[model samples]
Target: MNIKYNLVVLAAFCCTAIGSAQDIVTQEQAVKLALENNYGIKIAKQAVEVAENNTSVLNSGYLPTLTGAAGATYNLDNTEAEFSNGAPPTSLKGAESNRYNASVNLNYTIFDGLGRQYNYKSLKEQYQLSELQARETIENTVLQLFSVYYSVAQLTENLDALQETLEVSKDRLVRAQYQFDYGQNTKLGVLNAEVDINNDSINIISSYQELKNAKRDLNVVLGNALNPEFAVSTAIDFKLQFQKDDLFEKAKTHNVALLQTEKNIAISELDIKSNKSGFLPTIGLSGTYGWNKNNNNGASFVSVSTNTGLSGGLNLSWNLFDGGSTIIKVRNAKVNLETQKLQKENILIGIQRDFENAWEDFENKLKIFNIQQQNIITSQNNFERTQENFKIGQVNSIEFRQAQLNLLNAELSRNQAKYQAKLAELQLLQLSGELLNVDF
Candidate 1:
């Protein structure tokens, strides 16, 4: 009874998964889901935003700056005094000399060592690199989504096939039982049929479990609730056709990872220049405005004086000498830039090798799929003939069963080849940065 209950549950689950997953998922939906919820893409987008903000700050440095200042001063004694010898002078003493001053200063960098200019340019490049990184992230997410989507579709087909085999085996078992009771078929034949049915029943359950797991993974990838029922369309096939030479040329221009590496090298070289620029002179314009008044109670209140002045000059301060710090930094920056260039070269080599290998794999799988399609047809015919012979007593049941298994295996292989070929093609397209061009 327990086994019977388990079997019933398995059947129900299979039906549910298949019925709910019949709708084909669109490429647009996949891309939208990935952009909205994929964690990597989300992080990359945030990084780009941060870089933009940083660039804004860098740009602000080129603008004029204004600042205000206010302060109060208290002196315990009026310490300085002068007197004439021939005339009587007023002797004065104060408990405190109180003073207050307020001022506003404006500053502008009319010229610098061009450090600000270079810094801003480097920041702009950094911002572009960040944007490209985000794009790269999206590209990666799309490829991953496609992989899981097709994987689930492949499993769906396998489950359907297994369920069909299970039903056929069950019917065979029933027929064999009737024949055995009538003394036409032996009990062994009935038992063999029952065994086949049970085996298929197990396979069907396993396949359903696999499908469930696949669905769960896809849900996580889409940032959806795992329990939500989703019907994905299985009609989409992975098909990509792009000239390798053309794609390679496009990648040189458009591949974000490669472009980012090149950007790194450029920025690193800029870093060395920036560090060296520190040794150059800097120039600026500065001005100040303020108001002051002097008052003594014994005499009379003095008039307020408002002082304002503007000063502009070329200021040059070069680092005449340092304890080899500048040299060390410049050398480090140069080495780092060289290292980045070397890394970019390595990446180029790696991309070329990977593209070549993936293309070969895809082509090889295509050929295998073609071969397996023909083999499946031949195996089906042979299995059918064996079945007819078994019923007419010209061949044993064991031989018939073996032939049926052969046909089942052949069909399974053929289907696997088809999907495998598609997988290889998708992977190759991804490697060549051409997956995005594939139409749904």
Candidate 2:
């Protein structure tokens, strides 16, 4: 009785392990996991944080600097003094001295041709640019996630179709073997059927391997362990409702890349102003308060002394000449500004081109999807008719095999077209900066 109980326990454990090894991941869950755990998105978020931290008022030189310091020293030495008027020399052994000092200083830049103001503005814009760049990274990651997820779905469909074809081939093989055993069919027919069965088996294996690879890639995108067995939801559906003109207009302003370029132009203009500020005199205020003490141990004259004082001043500085480097910098900054403008134009052109290409692809895939959808139905009917005919010995194996292949190819094509259409639609939305808000 105990042995039987142990066996039952072992069986239950095995079942639980098998069940826990397989996971069912929906598309929405995959996207959420990627957003939470993707390494690239995390790095981009950190970069934005760094930019925010660097945009402080102190970094822009708007705040004064205050510093305080103190120190003390002790010394011991032999001292000798020579009197010029008297022809005698005097010496003392083990002379000792001590000294102390402390100070607090403040410095503030009063004026620098509005350079600080421009610098502050540029820093703010830099922070904004970093944020846009992070958003771009997120969008790209999400798009890639969607693509990989759909690819796995497509491969899964292919694997299913191949399995179905393998079953059909196996059935044909069995029929051929039975006929051969009864001396009703040629041995050549049995051999040919065996070859078809083997071929179908090989195709199924290959399709399953491809599906595994696709799932591995999806795991990589989701930042999950590579070896886990999981299944993705098989629903692939999306819609595009915006016109081309509307998409173009939205992309012009909302696209992260273009917005980043605009920020760069503004930053470059500020850079020019900052460099020009070097040509103007700068004004500042500085103040210091200090105390000092000195002691000569057991000395008759000036045994101890202490002093304290407070001092303040206004300072002015001007870079009268710098071998023309400042002016050259200003010129280069202006050139950079122009380059940024040209870059913005180039990005706009590229964005328009991408949007047009994606639009075209989306439309083309929709058409292909429709064609393949009808093809699958026709192929299925043909395959069924040919299969029945083969069973009745009214059609040859070659004709029936061809119909089977047609049905398999049609199903695979339809699956691919459906996913491809979804991908193209996603890409179009991505280019228009609407992908961030898209529902999975």
Candidate 3:
């Protein structure tokens, strides 16, 4: 019984650990999850659906529509009556009446001043534009995901650097104590070493807090529960391969906002045409088939009759005058179309400038990364020389500790530069509309 209880407790502990393990979603997995579950994206998707439905409704004007109707009614009346059987007769009577009718109506627009055509075309353009807007939302979500994921990883790397520094400081303190006991080092040296260790300890604590904050930020972006114990992959390589010229060219063609704006301008033009359609005549074909029934019950007798018939006709409607409302609407539509055209041009210019700026930022970050790589090498060598000198009693502990701190700073700078370069590359890719295609 004791052994069984121990086994059960061990199993429970293992199960709890597994359940509490941090979910490390990959970039692709994160994107897929967000597309499926992100509230903003879901709302955008619903908007797209509404646009599609509108398109369908607009298209329906071109198709024949059949409608059906049926109805029945009855009435009851009460009154006093008198009758004379001589040359004239006068009577007031209680009566009941009933009627039934049914009809099937059909309408086909043979011609509608071309309004339906223009409206349908405009709706199609609008639908496409909405889809493009949804794509833009997706791109933005992915950018946020990338930023959050890399931020968490960057903070984790900083923690590792701090921990390593802490360990090195502790080792130096131990050596300083032994050397002082053997009369090879001064008490001041040992005290300086101890102070450096204490500083590193503080740094480690600060780094831990930063890592926790980074994790929290990531969870918020991912729409996950805010728990700081999650783990993420920290090993990242920042080598970027891209051609600036190619990216710039792709941005002009593939950017979602630019494409969507162009579609908007097209739809605006169609809107102008549709609003002007009122001045033209509309032509249609209509048909109806129905059943009519009547029942009569009076003092004379009772009778019932039913009839069925079919009817068809051509229709033409023209609005010759409408208080100048049609003219005003046409002018307003024209103005709107012109405004949309100007807006589209402005958006194009903005996108071009954005692409150029992102490229510049990318190049600058790459240069910094290259410089920092050399700085790290130089700092590491200098720190090693200082360590040797301190061990041989040629230098004080202050010099050694400063050298160590310098190395740590150099490492941190390099890490920052590396990730900054990656971020800059990502920005450039996004501006160029290449992020969706990139395999990384």
Candidate 4:
């Protein structure tokens, strides 16, 4: 028997079931919109740039500093002088003195017990960690988008099925009314058909409302403005061809959380080095060039003087003790490093646990998908038989309605199972950190 258009066959529905005017989205297009407009992703990218800016040599204290200064001074006073031998005395009413000076200085830390190197390494690690965090945000956002998109598709399929049922009910009511008028069927039959039609209408309205809500949710995640209402295509497909061992390996290398924990451990080690550096001697180099001029009037000395010179020197500082502050800090840093090591181990264990569970779930969901496919086939065959009996008057209207409802239920169940399996697969991919690499 040929499956009728109202039965919602899985292979054919994707091609013709959805409304053409409303169906404006595909999974690929949805993903692209999310990447371009999602606010979380934009913020995360900015954070990565901040980390990049902090990873410079100047920020890591590996550069020299130069300073310049200039100043002028003037003085005026009356002056008097007397000879010690009492031969004469002298006085001047308007005596003036002026001086001008300018200087440039350069200072550089030549050595700091390798603390600068460790700090620079830490900055680089921080930058890498930011990149990992940004990648994680992208993956998580896209994952959410896929879930909502799939939901819209599921609801679209459900709405179509309900509309088909409503149409079928209306046709039944027309036939029932005609039969009653011709004395072929009783009034009770016509009333039953009417009641069923009302029920189908209600179901259609409810399904339609649910579909709109799902679309709205999808729009919000896609970063659409004003949460515009729209529809999506019912075309969807997925494949299950993953090996657990391969996923485990990928998680070890690509998982963002695990990588972040490892990075923190690296940073903690550097922190220990930085703290221990306080115990070492710091050596620095400094240079200064200065120019100065002075003019004197009515003075028993040189009338004008000028001086210019370049001065340079190296200085060293050794922190022999600081009330044991450095020792205490070193101890704390070592403890923190150990804690980070334990955290790394914990994260690794968690990744393994999550991957195993997700892999198991993926397999189970795929199995359920296969079973739903078979169940739909059985329901379809039974419905076809019931439909034939009803036409020939061998079966009643109630039996026909039951068969129709069964077929609809089967269609819904199979659609949900397919999407659930896809969701499970996506979870597995996310756990393995391979979601970012998915192109479609």
* TM accuracy, model 2: 0.89
> Model 3 misses residue 348 by how many Å?
2.9
Q: lDDT per residue, candidate 1, 358-393, as tens digits?
A: 778888988998998898889889977987787677
What would the per-residue lDDT of candidate 2 be over residues 258-314, giving only the tens digit for each residue?
A: 999999999999999998999999999999999999987653358899999999999
Mind sharing the TM-score for model 4?
Answer: 0.88
Off by over 4 Å in 1: 1-5, 20-23, 57-60, 73-97, 225-227, 236-238, 251-254, 293-314, 393-395
**Backbone clash count, each prediction separately:** 4, 0, 0, 0
Candidate 1 overall Cα lDDT vs. reference? 0.74
lDDT of 4 by residue, 183-210 (tens): 9889987878777766665666566667
Instruction: List the RMSD of every prediction in angstroms.
Output: 3.3, 6.2, 6.8, 5.4
lDDT of 3 at 222: 63
Winner by lDDT between candidate 4 and candidate 1: 4
Cα error, residue 325 of model 2, in Å, equals 1.8
Off by over 4 Å in 2: 1-21, 73-94, 225-227, 297-300
Which 10 consecutive residues of model 3 have the lowest summed lDDT?
10-19
Quantify all predictions' global Cα lDDT against the true fold: 0.74, 0.84, 0.76, 0.82
- Residues 82-116 of candidate 3: C-alpha lDDT, one tens digit per residue: 44554344344567768899999999989878888
Identify the leading candidate in terms of TM-score: 2
Could you tell me how far off, in angstroms, the CA of residue 332 lies in candidate 1 after the best superposition?
Answer: 2.2
